[model samples]
Target chain A: MTALLERVYAWRWSVLPPITGVAMMAMIVGALVAAPREIIEGEVQRLMYLHVPAAIIMYVAFFFTAFASVMLLWKRDIRWDAAARASAIVGVFLCGIVLVTGAIWGKPIWGVYWSWDARLTSTLILFLIYCAYLLARSVAGPLDEQAARYAAIFAIIGVADIPIIQMSVRWWRTLHPQPIVFRPDPALPNEMLVVLLIGFVAVLSLATWLISLQTDTERAAQRVSALRAEFDHREIA
Target chain B: MNVLGAVVAKDLKLAWRNRSGWLSAAAFSTIAVLTYSFAFDLATGDVRPLLPGVIWTTFLFAGVFAAGQSFQDEVDDGTFDALMFSPVGATSVFAGKLVANLIALLIIEFSQLILATILFDVALLTPELLGIVLIGTIGYVSLTTLLATMGGHVRGRSVLLPVLSLPLLIPLLIGAVRATGASLGLEAGTGPWMLLLMVFAVWATLAAVLLFPTAAEQ
Candidate 1:
């Protein structure tokens, strides 16, 4: 376990730019091809190419939190907790992009910048919740490993709410559209399908690059924070 | 019957004598209610519809506000170590802390409900809505009180409590909001809401019972 752990950190950061570049190029071309030129409402759905992929990426980001939360509880692994923290930073960025693009999309369609629909509300709540998690990480500031530990416990418990947050829309009569999740459309016309697939891959590759960078930064920061604390203690003594 | 009661009583004594401790919770509840009223005023004319949701949210936050002081001062003052050596089951200590926090929250909840009615002009103060609020409050308070104790041991505990508590409170929020929405004359069937409330209560109580000792030890 120790040997494998050593190798994992060794490779956490050296592997993503090229991957994301290729993915990004693919995404640009895919978007151009799929951009709706003439429809009842055109070009606004252009935001869909961006918004849908970003939403999916946020889900991937949250899964990192859930994974870390469980690992911390099960094995008391601080590394997992760090990964969770790292993911949250990335998750927030993705969630913010989703909200922004969503607002842009809504302007052309709903004639407003925002709505209190369930998805919107839940997404906002989800963003706030993770932001709360990040803020908790900052509260103890540098040199407080306790904050990370507490944040880990929080990450574990907080993920349990996502389902409820997601369901709260349909559970009650909320303005949010019902999830198209359960009933699968038998066939997507190839154009939409291809665009969505390419879009997901592109967003996912970028999310990976960002998540890796985040994890590296968190761990490095933790190290610097601990050293600073040690120096402070020596000076005080 | 043991030092649990003594510790509970001790923490309450500590908080009450501080003056700020007592008012911090009251102030939060009040501000929460005010903000809630103003936010609702923007959209809907009837504060009655949103009253119970606002009250429960206010109390949940109030509980979070007050619960972290659990053994915080005791820990800081170095009195907590001695408490551990005293003749009390950690469970009793937890119970006492949890109870004291609950008392503080209840006071805030009651005051907020009254002030909300008077201020928001929610004239229809039904016994039924109040009853639903009472049940919802119990479930929300117990979970928060316990979680606060657990999180309080961490550094930046003040920030830690809400991070942990809010997610756990989602089910309670749903039950409360749905129940409150129903109480406000929506078609909320009694059967489902009550079941949701009970589930939350049971889950929260069990966690508190199990972890009270851990919190005490921490």
Candidate 2:
């Protein structure tokens, strides 16, 4: 089990990116070609393939941040902190993409680039929370354990907002349309569904790859700092 | 319970001695209300429709300053470390800060309400309005108090507090504005908004209680 796990971890560095790259290319081409246009929204609805997946990825990234944060707090392990920080940075980046793509999609369909529709507003707020988390991380200094601890707590607290944000779309009177994909009976056509599934898988894989890369970089930096501190101490001795 | 009360008493005493912190918040709020009323020329128009939003916005902005003040002295003087090192737990410290901050915010909010009424020529003083104000302020302050604790150690915390707290406070703001609108006869029902405010308050309080120890250890 351990050897297999190690092999998978080692392979993640080389094989995952190319696979993700191919999947992304296929998703884009398939979304543009194979996916049927909405009768109402036409070509503009195509943005859904990117926008919805980005939004979903943003959620996934933050959830990872929150989960990693919990682990950090419980274990006092720097690796958990590294994972949490990397995921948060990636989460914020993906959230920004979600917002931009959403605005692009909304401009043509909603007749305005921005509105206080419940989903948009909630997503905007989610983006803001991510920004705040990053800010908290930045101001605390990189090597500060207190910062990591506090950030973990903040991440855990911040995630409680997600479910509420999701529900707000339904509970409130919103200009945004209700879910057509994940409903009790999905209304999405088969072709669009297939394309969207591709988009989801591709984006999710890319996000995972990005987060792992970031975590590895952060961990390496910490190791370098630790070695430098040791060398300095030896020289002083 | 005693620990909580003692913490609250100590905070209230500190706030009393350093009245300028909350006083400045109130003064800032009054200026904001006056600026809004004058800028919009509320005297010549029907300002009734805008009262709820104006009042809540004033409180929200003003509350940031108040929240920042909640821990400024302790953080600056290094008493925050002392408090954390004390025998009392994080919950007591958080509860104490919450009560102190709530009192400070309510004072500013009430004064803002009075100024808003006078400036806008609207009679906003009533039991319903007071109830909405109390509930809304409690919810807002609960969340901001926690954020303020985290932001207090950060440089540029004055700016950081609002940036950190505002997004989380959106549900509270929406509920307050809607409920306040109902109180002012500009809206039909307040039940849903009140429920939202209550949920927000409970959630924020739980988050603060659970997170404060980890946050305060720094």
Candidate 3:
């Protein structure tokens, strides 16, 4: 079992990219060509295939960031900090995608690029919170323990705020459409559901690959900094 | 318990002695209200519909200013280091700061209420409105106090404090506005909004209790 796990770990970098690329290509075909067009909104509805999956990925990335943050605080492990930082960066990037695509979809349907509706506003706020998280990390200087702690604390607070924000905004306005994908009886027909499922797998795998690459880069950067510090101390001695 | 009281008393006393801190916050809120009144042309319209948003926004700005000043001042003057060296735990320090900030925010809210009543020609001192103000202020101050501590000693804290805290305070903002509107008869069904405000207050306080030690410890 250990040997198998090691082999898989070694092959992940080489295996993941091609698989993700293929899955992504399949998703694009499924979304554009395979799914039936809506009677009211034709091609614009296809944006849902990308929009919903990206939103899911963004939420998952932030959730992972918050989980890793809790571990960092409790275990004092720099690895967890790197994981948290990488996840947050990915989460922020995906959130931007979700917002921009949402705006594009909204333009034809809502007749405007943006609305002060509940889900849109809450997602925007989420984006701002994580962007501020990255800003706080940068401002606190590089890899400082206190900075890590602060980011961890802030991420936890932001996650905790998510439910309340959703509830309040839902009450504040109801312009956004209801969920069609995750219901007990999903509103989508069979064909669209298949495309959505494919999109989900493709996006999730892509996010995983990006987060892994980012975490590795952070770890490498930390190693270089440590080595440079060691060389400086030896020279001084 | 004694330590908590001492910390609260110390913060309150310091705020009182250095009156400019919260005083400036109050002045800022008042000026903002005046500016909004002019901008919205309060004389020609029924400003009742707009009063809830104005009141809440002003209170939010004031609360952020006071919370940031209270923490950053301690860090700047090195008093936070001395306090950390003392026998007090982080919870006491956090709870104390929270209470002090709560009182300061309440004062600002009440003053803003009066200013709105006079400027917007709306009676805002009703029982329901008062209760909403109290609960909303508690949540707002609780959240800002935590973020202010986290942002303290970091560069560009003046920018960091609001950016960090405001997104988290959206629920409070929404709840307060709707509840206030309900109480003032511009909207209906205050129950859900008030419940949201109460839940947010409790969650913020609990989170601060759990996280303050990690933030405050050296």
Candidate 4:
């Protein structure tokens, strides 16, 4: 286990960045070139590639948050808490990207930027649960690891909705289409998908870079805060 | 049993002796029902339409406020730790607290029901209707007591309890409200709603049994 962790941290430092950067470039080329031209509501539906991948990456970010939280709770390690919080930062950002890009796509396709249908409502609920996760972390304050344990507990429970959120359209036929990118006869053409795939990689690499920076900074900030508190107490005494 | 009962009696005596502590709940409950009245009564057409929602919201919040101070008193007196180590199982401590919260909740529930009648025009006083209200309150109070303990220990004593609890308590509130409303029409609440209420009751009771030790020990 220790060797595995060392490998993870080592790869996280050296290998992940280049891999992420390469993935982003692949996604961009895929989006701009690979996805084929298609029409939705009279305009080219090239955004499909970008939108779907962004949403998928957001889910990936959430998975990491949940996974890191599990490690925090199980191992009682501050580093796991840091990683979990770092992932939360990325997850929230990716969630924002999902909402924004989807809104941009929805305007032309769905005729409105928002709808209160079950699919949308469930998505909104997922957002709220994530907000609750953030709130739980903030409330835990300097006891970040303790807070991380419970926050991760909630994150783990909360991710159950991800499946529902994803398949809500399938489970119930709402305005949202079923999976368009993965099926054999994907709704979009190959060219547009290439550009979208590129856009997704760009976003994913950006997310990973930001998470690494955030996790490193959190460690520093925690140390500083502990020292400050100790100094304040000493001065008072 | 003896020690637990004695502790229960002690808590009840302490509560009764503190004029404001016991009455604090009554005062808070009264104000909460009035606020619901002010908010909902204005849309008074078929006040029955929103009766379940209105009544449940008032009762739930009122019960939260009513029972919130039970732990605050324990914490303030610095007796929570001692109570935990007493020669009694923690479940009895929970039962005692549950009883106090239940009685306090009943006071608030009945008061809110009165407010619901005058404000929301819910004709819930028929025998069957009243029984439904009693049962619903039983489920609601059980959940609230457990949640209140969780909330009462947190950063903001009173404010934290409701926000943390409302998301969870929504299903319970929905079921109770629906049951209360359905009973008014001589229709028994359907199976799923009743099951939800039972689930909530069991969840709250189990959480209380399990988690109250953390509060008591803290």
Candidate number of the best TM-score: 3
**Model 3 chain B, poorest ten-residue lDDT window?**
B147-156
Which sections of candidate 1 miss by over 4 Å? Answer: A1-14, A34-41, A73-77, A175-187, A230-237, B1-20, B23-47, B82-92, B111-130, B146-178, B184-218
- Per-prediction TM-score, chain B alone: 0.85, 0.95, 0.95, 0.82
The better-scoring model by lDDT among 2 and 3 is: 3
Superposition error at A174 for model 3 (Å): 1.5
lDDT string for model 3 (A1-237, tens) is 969966876776998898899989999999999999998987899988888999999999999999999999999887788888899999999899899989998999999999999999999999999998887777754457888888899999999889989999988887989998788999889999999999998998898889989988888877776788789999999
Please list the residue runs of candidate 2 whose C-alpha ends up more than 4 Å from where it truly belongs after superposition.
A1-7, A166-172, A227-237, B151-153
Docking class of 4: incorrect
lDDT tens digits, residues A4-81, model 1?
A: 978875764565677678777877777776444537557776666678788878978987887886675567556676
Write model 4 residue lDDT over A1-237, tens digit each, in one string: 999977776677676678778877677556556554454444435555556766777778788988887677567677777777788777777777667767777887888998755555555555666776677667765544445555665566456435534443232235666676788886655565556666766777777787888888877877887899889999999
Local distance difference test values of all predictions, in order: 0.70, 0.82, 0.87, 0.64
Better candidate number, 2 or 3, judged by TM-score = 3
Give the top-scoring candidate (DockQ).
3
TM-scores vs. true structure, each candidate: 0.79, 0.93, 0.94, 0.75
Docking class of 3: medium
The CA-based lDDT of model 1 is what? 0.70
Worst 10 residues of 2 chain B by lDDT: B146-155
Cα lDDT of model 2 by residue, B1-218, tens digit: 88889999999999999998888888888888888878877778688887788788889999877886777789889999899889997788889989988887877777777777777778877888888888888877777777776645567878877887787777788788888888778878888888887887778787887887777776
- The model with the greatest lDDT is 3
In model 3, state the lDDT of residue B100: 88
True contacts kept of each: 0.16, 0.53, 0.81, 0.02
TM-score of 1: 0.79
Mark the regions of model 4 whose C-alpha exceeds 4 Å error after superposition: A28-33, A41-76, A105-107, A144-212, A230-237, B1-29, B40-44, B67-70, B87-95, B126-157, B174-189, B200-218
- The local lDDT score (0 to 100) that residue A4 gets in candidate 3 is 93
